[model samples]
Structure formats: C-alpha cells, structure tokens
Target: MQIRDLPYPDPGVPDARSGPRFLLWLGRNQLGGQLRSLAWGLLHFGSIAGLPYMVGVAVEAVLDRSGGRLALAGALIVLLGIAIALGDTMLHRTAVTNWITAAARVQQLLARKTAALGSALTRRVAAGEVVAVSTGDVEKIGWFVEALSRFAAAALTVVLVCVGLLVYQPALGVIVALGIPVLALAVLPLLPRATRRADHQREKAGRATELASDTVAGLRVLRGIGGEELFLDRYRTASQEVRTAAVRSARMWAVISAIQVLMPGLLLIAVVWQGVHLAREGRVTVGELVTVYSAIMILNYPLRHFEEIAMAYSFSRPSAKRAARVLSLQRTAESTVSRSRDGSERGEAMAPVMAQPPADDSLPPTGDLYDPATGLLAPAGRLTAVVCGDPDEAGRLAERLGGHPAFDDAVDMPSVRLGDIPLDDLPLAIARTAVLVQDKDPVLLSGTLRELLDVPASGAVNPEEALDAAQCSDVLDALTQASAGDDPMTAHLTERGRSLSGGQRQRLALARSLVTDPEALVLDEPTSAVDSHTEARIADGIRHLREGRTTVVLTSSPLLLDRAERVVFLADGEVAAVGAHRELVHTEPRYRAVVTRETDAERVVDRDTDFLTELDIEETA
Candidate 1:
C-alpha cells in the first residue's frame, strides 16, 4: 500500500485512564482487521483443542478390541491434524498483517503530529525525544495494539476448552479450569514494576539521543574550540547510562519470564499428578485422563499470550504518552475574520493602505516594530542594528521579530502588542512572511547551490545575484577546489549539508534568506563565519540588494554597521541608543568599545604605547 493511504491512530486520550480503554479506542477504529485476526486465532486454537480429543478416541478404540473403530479414530486424528495445520498457517498470516497495519498507523500519527508542530516542535520537545518517539515508540505501540486481538481469541479458546473438559470428565476438568485463572493473574503484580523500569529506560534513551543530536549539530563548533573529545566523552557517558537503564529493564522482564515459564510447568505437573490419582482410584477412564492432561498442556499458548500482553502494555503506554505530548502542541493563532481584496482584515478598519506598501501590511506603518515587553521600537525602512551586550536578550528580540510562540501573545505568553496590532491577531503566515530572522546557525538543507538559494517565498532572483549578495562566490570556488570539475550549480548536498564547510554552509544559508527578499530581513551575525573581506562584501551587497527593504542586522561588527542607515544599540534588551554608525561610534562609549575590539590593530596598539610612539617618530623624521 502507498504511504499516504496509511491509517493514523490518535495517541492522545485522557491521562486518567486504563491501558485497555486506550487499546479499545484503537481497536474500534480498526475493527475489520482486528475481527479477521480474532477469527483466525479462534479457528487455530479450536483446532488445537480438537487434537487432545482425537488422541483420546484413538487410545480408547485401541484398548476396546474394536479394529474398525480404531481405524476410524486414526483417520479422524489425521483429518484433525490437517485442520490444525491449515488453521495455524492462516492464524500466522492474519496476525502478522495486523501487526504491519498497526505499525503503519502509529507511524502516520507521528508524521502528522511532526508536521503540525512545525518549527515549534524543536523549541518545545528535545530533538532526541522526538527521534526516540518516532523510531522506538512507534514499534512498541504497534506491538501492543496488534497483540490485543490474539490475546482475546486465546482467552476465548481457553474458555471453550475448559467447558469441553467439564463435559468429558467433571473432577479433572475442575482442576484444569481452576489453574487457568491462577496462571493469568500471577503476572499482574510484576507488570507495574516492569512498566516503571521500561519508562525509565525509554527516558534515558531519549536523553542519550538528544545528547547525540546536540553534539553532532555543534560538532564543528566543538572541534574549533578543541572540545570534540570532551563532547564525545559526554556522549559516551550518556550512552552508558542508557545501557545501564536497558539492563535494569531487561532484569525486570527476565524475572517476569521466569515466572511465566515456571508457573506453567508447575501447573502441568499438578494436573498430571492429579490425573494419575484419578486413574488409580478407577474413578476416571484412561482416555478421559489423557484428554485432561492434553488440555492442560494446551493451556500454555494462552498463558504465554497473557505474559506478552502485560509486556506489550508496559512498553506501549509511555510511548503513547510521548506521542500524545507531541500531538497536543498548539499551532500559532490566526484571526477568525477573512481577508479583504486589498489584503486587509475584513472585521477591522483601523489603518489605511499605503501606495506600493510593504508586501505584508500586518506590520505597522512608520516602520516602528515595537515589542511592548521591553518597550523597544525598530523604526521601519531604516537599517536598524540591535547591539545587545547580553546574548540572551538579543535572542529574545530575534524570536519576537520572527513571531516565535514564546514571544507571540497567542501562545501562553503575556499579550504584548507589536506596534498597535495584537501579535496573535496578525495572520501567522503574513507575520512570518513580513519578517525573516536568520539565526546564527541556520539549517542548510541538502540541495544544489541553485536549490539552496531558491528558499521559501523567494522570487526569481538569478542564482548569480543571490550568491554575490551573500559573498558566496569564493565558497562556490571552494566546492570546485574540493572536487575536480564538480558542477557548482548541480552538485548534490548531503543530509544537513554535511558535505560542505561550516562557513560555506553559513553563507549559503544567508544567500537563501537574501533570495527570499522579504520586506524586513533580520540577520543575527550572518557573517560571523566568513573572512573579513567576504564579510565586507556581504555588508556592501546587502545594502545594495536590499536598498528599499527594511533590514535589521544583529551584530557587533563595525564593518557591517558602517553601511547601516541607523544603528540601535541594545542594552539589557532595550533600545539604548538609535543613530547612524559614525554617530554611535562617537557618542556611545559602549558602542565605541565594541567597535574598537573589532579591529586587531587597535587591540595591539592599545596594548603597546611604545609602538604608537615609534610610528609617530618615524613619520616626523
């Protein structure tokens, strides 16, 4: 079947509920497959029950001195064997089908939830947790769901077998019937402990996965700072912790398995001993005793399923909880009112539309992008630079401008309006379209240079133009250097852009954002990776390419600020000062200090007054 046609079972129900109730919800949705599986299981088990009776008849006929009846009984036994074989094959086929379908359903649900959460997912849930839920949790959940029908059919077979035994011989039948409940109920106490251990193991696994993801994402940075070995050691430690948890979980399951096997063996021994006594007393015939013994032996299949159901439930419950948590993440809020022909909200008539206005008018006029929380306004159409001494405040401002949920009023945060518009009222699509924030480490998806530059909402800007704008001409040359005669335009990028250098990947990401040509582009130190020459070129190219568009550059780089129409120095996340680059250099001491550090010559000169004096004396001579 096609992947798109796969079923998606919801994992979120109520928290205060039993596992069976949750299972019932899944079963009800997939009744046809479950019923078919159930039918096959019953048929197979019924045939198994018939075997003991056929054997008992053969024994009776051989002992009775009736040759014709013995032949007839032998023939019936052969027919029953054929029936058992046919039923067993069909049972296996149906059960496996149920398992595959259940696995598909869980996978579909996970994929759907991931899509719904979008970028918010990574912010809310750890990347490792998400990876664990999709790969490991889906399988465990499917195992439990598929096991339910088989368990039900096995239970029914046990009941029918017990009833048949009672009709054949009441005294021995009662003993076999009494043992069924004991075998099933014995493992219930062990379930809670097993489940707890499984939960712990799953949690540890997720943490380990998250640690690995973080380490891999920042591998370049770690290596640059000579901390690759340190991070690798940390990951190894985390992996060992996961291994320990897994072993602890395995130990609990081992105990439960021993009990399942040992209890059934003891039950078989008891039934056999009781049957011999009955035969000695001459109260039961030999054939009837054999039938009772055979039925008790057959009880093993159903009892084994009881153990499996317990194990499946123990593993699946936590997985379901994790899937539910992902699904429950809310999307960004939008207005209920429809948009007008002019792209304005139909319900409200507050602001007049301007001529040749910015692509998205949801952002206020006068170019004043305000965040009420910190009382900051980034005036429109001007090159506004945010200089935060605190890195976290800069991050917060960048998130707000990008309309991330943490700063967005609609997503469990305080109602801090942006300009006069309620941040939530503005359409999420429009808000995102208006402002594009490029993080320091933006993701570079696997694609050719041409494909990377053609990002979301980007018009047909020539690949050459975008590459030049982001100062990626050298990066393109570097790709050719790495591989002889490799087509820069058609070269295939590996997953997560692993094939490229860190600086190359970063520049490509910047080019992609520039290609989008958004009304307001928010770049957070977009040139932190590239050389000084490339950085200056990018700064110049950005000013030229986005001459009319509102661009906000978050950097302490004086080379970039030198081209800005206005620079807003951010102190403790507030707009400390707003003016031209040269003006900030002369007026703000903090700005001067920050910009002075950008030049290595100034740092060396500041360190040595003798060097400065020698330069002045040589000029005078």
Candidate 2:
C-alpha cells in the first residue's frame, strides 16, 4: 500500500514470543513492500556493479583503436547511469514507505495494547519505558525493517560481482571471492560487544527518561520541600551518565565503522597490487587491471550497507523485544480463556452476566455492588461514603469496585458482584458502563474542553451541568481567557492540562466523569485538590444531581461524609462501622478520630488564611 493508505487497515496480531520473533513478524506481514524495495535496490546496486565492467570494455576499445566498440561502451555507460538515477530515486521512495508503515503499525499495536491493559500497563511498566517504546524505539524498529531489503540487494550484488570476476578473470576472481567473505564476516566477533554496549546505553537512557519524567511531575513538591536544586542536581548526574553511556556506545560503533573501511581498503590494495603484477607479466591486460581495481572500489559502497544492516539490527532487536513484552500483557488474568482463537466469541466473558435479555440499556444484575473480599456493599440508587485510613487500601478497593485487578500480578482474587452477577464475568464494555471508577489523579487528555467531555456517556448529565456540579466556572474562564477568541468549549488544553492548576484539572476531570453519568460511580478523593468551600459545593451538587444513582466515594472528608446517605468506615480492609456520618462520629471512636483529624486539618488551613488576610489588611492601612 502507498504511504497515504496507511496506517494499515489492520496491523495484524503480533507474535510476542521473543524480540527477534516480533521483528520477523513485522517483516513477514510487509512482504509485498519489502519485495518492491528489494527490486528497486537490486536495480540501483546492479547499475553500480555493472559500471566497472563497462569502463573495462571502454579501455579495451581505446587500446584496439575501434570507433564502433568505443561508441557501444559509451552507450552502455549512459544506459547504466540512467538506471542508477531512476533506481536510486524509486529505491528511496519504497524504503521510506516501508519505514513509515512499520512505525505506524507498531504505534497502533502499542496503542491497542495500552487500551486493553488500561492502568495496569503502567503498574507493570514504567511510564518512561512506555514513552520510549512508543516513540524512540518505534523509529529504531522501522529503521531495521526498511534496511532488510537494501541489505538483501547489496549482498546479492556482491555475490554476482564475485562470480562475474571468476568467469572473466579467474586469478583475480579468487582474490575478490576470498576477500568478500572476510570483509563481510570480520565484524562478527566484535558485534556481541557492540550489542551489549547498545543495550546498556538504552537501559541507562530509559532510567534517565524516567527520572526526568518524575522530576517534572513532582517539580512543585520539590520546591515546596526546598529540594528543587537537589533534585535538579540529581537529574544532572543522571543526564551526564546517559551522555557518558551514549559516548561509550558510539566509540564502539565507530571502531566497527573503522574496521569496515580499513579492511575493505586493505583488500583493494592487495587486489590492485596483484593486478599490476599480472599486467607486468602480460598474463592480464590493462583493461582487466582497471576493471579489478575499480570493482574493489565499487564493492566499498555495498560494504557500508552491510555495516548499516548490522547497526540497524543491533538497535532494533532490543526495541522490538520491549514492544513485544508490552503487547503480551493481558487485561485480565483469565483473558486467554475468555477469548476464542478466531475471536468468534471475544465477549464470551459476558455470557454469564447476560444470560437473559434486558429491556433497558443497563446490563443484568442491576442491584448493589458487593465486594466479596471486604464485604463492602454499595446499595443501589444511593450515595455511600467509605472512610478508609490507608490511602493504598482505599485505592485498591476502588479499583476492585470496577472489576479491575488492584495489583499488577493480582490473579484469582475475590470478585466484586453486581448483586448476584459477577462484575468480572462481564465484558469490559458492560462493566465499565455499569461502574465508572474515577481515581483522584484523573488525567485531562490534551483536547478542547468539548472533546474531553465528549465520551460514551449515558446522556443524563450535560457538560454544562457536570461542569457546574464539578465547580469549574473559574476553570472555564481561565481556559477561555488563555485561548483568546476561543470559547471555553473550544479552548484547547495542553497535554495533562499542564496550563491549569491542580484544583482546576481535578474539577475538569470530575466534570468529565459526571458527564459520563454511569449507573454506579466510584470516586477516590475527588475533592482532595479543591478548597473546602468548593468541596462542599461539589458535595451538594453530587447529592442533588445523582438522586437515583449508585455513588460510592472513598474519602475521609467530613463534609462529603456528612452529605452521604450512609457511611461505611473500613478498618483492616473490612467494614468496621456502617451508619449515618453523624451517628458514626458520635458513637464509633475509630471512625470519629479519622473524621475529627480531617476537620482539624481544615481548621488549621482556615487559621492560616485568616492570619494572611489580617497581615495583608495591616499592610494596606
């Protein structure tokens, strides 16, 4: 297919058994493109190889003093030059097509895998590693894939040239044939060293990328702790180490390059020296001597291709392996069983959940959400606030509520059910629709506010209403003002909403979740970044808006807890107390202590604000 026709209709399923295997799979799928590239490559290199022979004939024609013979050689030379020009141009185009298509296919596969794995992909692989794989690694992989066909053509040209010499001049043929193997195979022993260094450099680079990402993400925290300079110094050290590793890796490759040139030059010297002796003895003619000498020089061109293919493979192998490992990740522990070989019954997991048809859009088992492990039940069509002391446990429980594995390797874990129907037994689409879990750090993808809020929502809550409930009027104003003439809905956000404050990003994310308007929504510390007043407003909005939906909140906020219809205080991973927030505050000391500490924290903030206000008022006077 042409470059415009890409990114392939289907990238095709990959073989993730090993890195080399993955590379093979990519090439095998693009056989048609590879063949086209190979044809062009052969035509180009064939012209280069044919040039020396034509020059030899021209020399012979001059020595013989024959005008017809000289004119014929000139005509052939012109034809070969034309072939060189056209072949080289087309070769470049086909090679580029292969490169872009390969990269596009890998990107699509990575995207598909990432979507399938969801948040678990990052839990298993570092965010930096993923970024590296999707960006830099993809380029390296494409480089090798595009090099394969050219290398094939170059190697073939070398073979045919050696054979032509054997037929035309047997003595020189022996020398060229013997030297060709040495030139090609001489770098084999050093390649292992080169590959190791490349791998080490890549590893160091990945770590450095991860460090930079972390430093940027927490730059504000570093400044708050008076450690920004310290972190900066650490990143500098990491950066220097990466540079050092890259330089070391480059030095090795340079040595290999030197070998490629030096060995070929030495072979040319030997061939020319021998050719002169043969001419002196009258055993070979002057035209043959020139042919042998110029042929060695032409051989140098293909030799560079050999080194390039080696270098490309050395780099792309590791990249392909990293890509393979990510693609191998499964969304669920038992996904292999749920999906059929032909994908005929890909949604087989939902068979148990959808045993009978339903009249409404909602799936069957439309009742309370019950986590078997913690004995936590969120009653249907009500707001339930869960107070957990440990944030990690709260996060794990929230993930479990949506039928997702809390830990990276969690398997055969207790299942959460929608009443009698197991949530994990349903297809991802149904499960996601049934229970929408919004973690505290919800990402604001780069797009206009309208696009960000445009999701597969239930159509119950409009973006305006959700934004109002999320208390994002200031956010809209900020976006609109920053975007100049653009409306808030059309105002584009930068990646991760970097332009917005933490409170604004959180409010916008909350607005997006509210827009989805799922039957059951689980929010983890949704109001943590917002002020107490805004949090109170959000609490009121949620209560008024979600009048008949299942809303589960995992937070220790007193205001949110007070507004909840029923509060479940979890201790030691199980429900320790369940009642109205007022009843729990009055009766349960464990529950009351948690809420009291949060309330005290809010009061401290109030006192600090008041002190600042008083100092400002005095300064104004």
Q: What overall lDDT goes with each candidate model? A: 0.73, 0.86
Deviating ranges (above 4 Å) for candidate 1 = 1-4, 7-28, 64-124, 221-237, 331-370, 375-383, 407-435, 547-550, 589-621
Candidate 1, residue 481: the lDDT equals: 66
Worst 10 residues of 1 by lDDT: 337-346
lDDT of each residue in 1-621, candidate 2, tens digit only: 788897778889999989999999999989999999999999999999999999999999999998899999999999999999999999999999999999999999999888766676788899999999999999999999999999999999999999999998998889999999999999999899999889988988888888888888898788899998888888899889889988988999999999999998999889888888888899999999888888889999988999999999999999999999998876666532211112111222221232333455455446777775666778778999999867688888888887776554256456677856777677777888888999879998998999999999989899999999999999989988999966799999999999999999998999899999887899999999989999999999998888899899999999999999989888877667778999988777678768877476765686698799999999999
Clashes of each: 1, 0
Candidate 1, position 224, lDDT:
85
Q: Give a tens-digit lDDT track for model 1, residues 1-621.
A: 222445543533433244445455666766887888789888778788888887788788878977888888788878877877887787777766666776676666667656544455787788989998788887887788778888988989989988988888988888777877887888789889889999998888888899998998787789889999998899899899989999999999999889888887888898789888889999888888787788788778777888888888889899877866775565555434322222211232224222343455653323445554444455556676777767766766676666664413343343223345554555666666667789877887776666776666647456678788887877788766655656777666777778777788888888888888776788998888888888898899888887777788888888898887777676654556667789887677676767665465765565477677889999999
RMSD of each: 7.3, 9.0
| Segments of candidate 2 deviating more than 4 angstroms | 335-365, 419-427, 476-495, 598-621
Error of 2 at 462 (Å): 1.3
Cα misplacement distance, residue 298 of candidate 1 (Å): 1.6
Enumerate residue pairs that collide in model 2: none
lDDT of 1 at 102: 65
